[model samples]
Target: MRIVWFRQDLRCQDHPALSEAAQKGEVLPLYILNDTHPGKWVMGEASRLWLHHSLKALSDSFNGHLAFYKGDPLNILPQLIKETGAEGVYWNRCYEPWAITRDKKLKEHLKKEGLDVQSFNGSLLWEPWETTKGDGTPYKVFTPFYKTSCLKGEPPRTPLPKPTLTCAPLPPSSLTLNAIDLLPKKPWGKEVFSGWEPGEAGAEKRWEIFLKEGLKGYKVGRDLPAQAHVSRLSPHLHFGEISPHQLWADVSKIEEGHDTNHFLSELGWREFSHNLLYHFPSLPEKNLQEKFDRFQWKKDPKLLKAWQTGHTGYPFVDAGMRELYATGYMHNRMRMVVGSFLVKNLLLHWHEGEAWFWDCLFDADLANNSASWQWIGGCGADAAPYFRIFNPITQGEKFDPQGDYTRKYVPELAKLSDKYLFRPWEAPEEILEQAGIVLGKDYPLPIVDLKASREEALAAFERIKEK
Candidate 1:
């Protein structure tokens, strides 16, 4: 018998471990829940909620035969082995530092017990170690790394087909889905997030939707938050509800063009993040460029709270934060805008923004979240130039030209014209009164002066560069 262990790779299709297990023998489908396993990398409220729904969907796929156990995998896997008399265990790999450490130790212990243990690349398009510079070192910048990876390849191997399974009966200690309690005691997620369907089927639905609606205009429209031109697939990809290989294959069906290549490069960024994390386990905590350590960052609780609650009074920044609060997701362009606002305009550390997003984002991926925040804060490898500060007012006016995205999330500013919509503080009192708005009462005054803050941020950044 074979035990098919599920971790972040939750779905069944094109899953190397599950597919291989089915081909070999009777499969004991398993998901072990140990919040202690990943240490401080434990699931946040949003991820916890998604996991609950995902497990239910996975169990339903197994026809209610999946074993859901709550314990350390060391203790639980042994018990499961004894229960089923399984000769081998198989699973897809996880790339997080904690997951890497845990998987290695677990694999060693299991193999010592004389049971066959196997793991496969069920998550990434290429193994993180596979892509490297010609000198056999990791690439620190993105463009050369992206171009080099493209040139080095036989394109991604075709995704494996779903394998037929011979199921084993569940063990007596198997826990019910409710016992996991990935859902919150509070009702915030269920109430706010009804738009997503969390399962393999749901992943397929989103894949189809993106292809039909988003493929043609993604190059131009992806940056426009008001348009439905981007795929909301990050959470599913994070949960392993969908595979990059599958997404790649489908997009490849499109006639090769700028739009298709742009979308593929975004996927490459996901790959690049894992590449960064694998090589530098300190990714979530330490800045990649050590010079950033000297960068002056403030610890004003008011600024942090203002940014988190979406009341910074910058329309685009606030809209992104509010959207994250109201619906657990933010548009990518807005993510960069808000990230720059917190780190640059507010002079708060990038870690503060990173931590907030870690808690609030439904698709809060460790590698992408940390790497992207550092990139925007101008402290990471392949980071933006320090001089290229994002002007949030102008960003809002440009991308969300008609104020549609702003009005949706920041409805208090709905009556303001596009001219003053993004920078409401600059509006005259007559216009404010006409629009039935009051600064700091109905909405908020800009928490920091844009021009003043920009100059301060630039000077502070220069000091760090000199150091």
Candidate 2:
């Protein structure tokens, strides 16, 4: 028998390790919740909730034979090997710095014991090492990285067909799903996960829906928060319910256009983020550009709390934060708007935003989250310049012109006119009363004066630049 360990890859389709193990002999599917290895980067509550549903679905696909265990995999795998009499262990790779360290140790130890141990690339379209510059250095800028290396290089592998499996019976010692305790004790999950379906089947359904409905106007419409131009596949992709290879293959079959090219480039960005993380493992905690170490980041807990709870008084910013808190997902445009607000307008540390998103977002990946936060903070490779702070009111006016996206999340402003929807503070007293709202009562006053805060942020950037 061969042991197929399930990590981020939860699907039966396009699963490399599971396919290989099934080809060899009877496969014992196993999942270990190694909470100790990740240290500060432990899986977040929202992600854990998703995993519960996902695991249940995957187990069902295996006819209820999937085994679950918690604690160190190094300890658990050996015991599983003894019990199942498995000759080999196989799993796909994880790219987090801590995961890399843990996997290296585990692989060496397993090999020392003379067991067949192998890993596969089931997640990424291109391995991090596969797409470096001619001199063997990793690309720092995204455009050159995508165009020069990825687009100019060999295409990603065509997706594999799901392999047939001769399954092993469940071991008696396997823990029940509830015993894993992946769901939060807080009573928030039912509503947050209402529209979400978290499994391979669900991933297929979502991909089909996006291809039919969202892919046509994607190039221009993605920037508009009110439009349904996005795939909404991040959480599924992160959990490996669907593989990038599958997406790449499916999209490649379409007649090429700006929409198809742009959509593919977004995937390229995901690859770029992973490349940055693998090459610069300090990405989650430290600034990629060292000069940012001298930068003065603020420490106002009150502002942080306000930002977290979506009471920031900037409708665009508040809407984004509240959307995240309520749904475990936020629109990408909103992510940038709110990220800019936190790190620039509020002048708080990017780490603060990164940590919060890590806990809250269903798709909160270490590479994407850390790299994005640093990009917004102007401290990452190919980062947005510090002076280009997003003006929340202007951003709302531009992207959510009809206020459809903002009003849905910030319902207090639902009755206000487009004229005053984004800038309620500018509304006359009578206009406010007509909307059945009062400033600082039904809704908050502006958290900070935008012009003043922009100047302050620019001055702060100048201080660091001078140093």
User: Model 2, poorest ten-residue lDDT window?
Assistant: 32-41
Candidate maximizing TM-score: 2
Winner by lDDT: 2
Residue 207 lDDT in candidate 2:
97
lDDT tens digits, residue span 1-467, model 2 = 88999999999899999989989989999999878875588988899999999999999999988999999998999888888788999999999998898889999999999999999999999999999999999999999999988999988988889999988988877998889889998887779987789999999999999999999999999999889999999999999999999999999999999999999999999999999999999999999999889988889999999999999899999999998989999999999999999988899999999999999999989999988998989999889998988989999999999999999999989999999999999899999999999989999987888888989999988888897
| lDDT value for model 2 | 0.92
RMSD of each: 1.1, 0.8
Provide TM-scores for the models: 0.98, 0.99
| Backbone clash total, candidate 2 | 0
Which pairs, if any, clash in model 2? none
lDDT score at residue 2, model 1, on the 0-100 scale? 95
What is the C-alpha lDDT profile of model 1 across 1-467, one tens digit per residue?
89999998889889999988898889999998888764466778888888888889999999998999887898889888988899999999999998898889999999999999999998899888888887778888988878887546658879888788988998888889998777887877866667898888998999899898887899999999999888999999999999999999988888999999999999999999989999988989899989888888999999899999999988899999999988888999999999889988999999898888887888989999988988998888899976688999899988999999999999999999888999888899999999999999999888999889989999998998887
TM-score of candidate 2 against the unseen true structure = 0.99
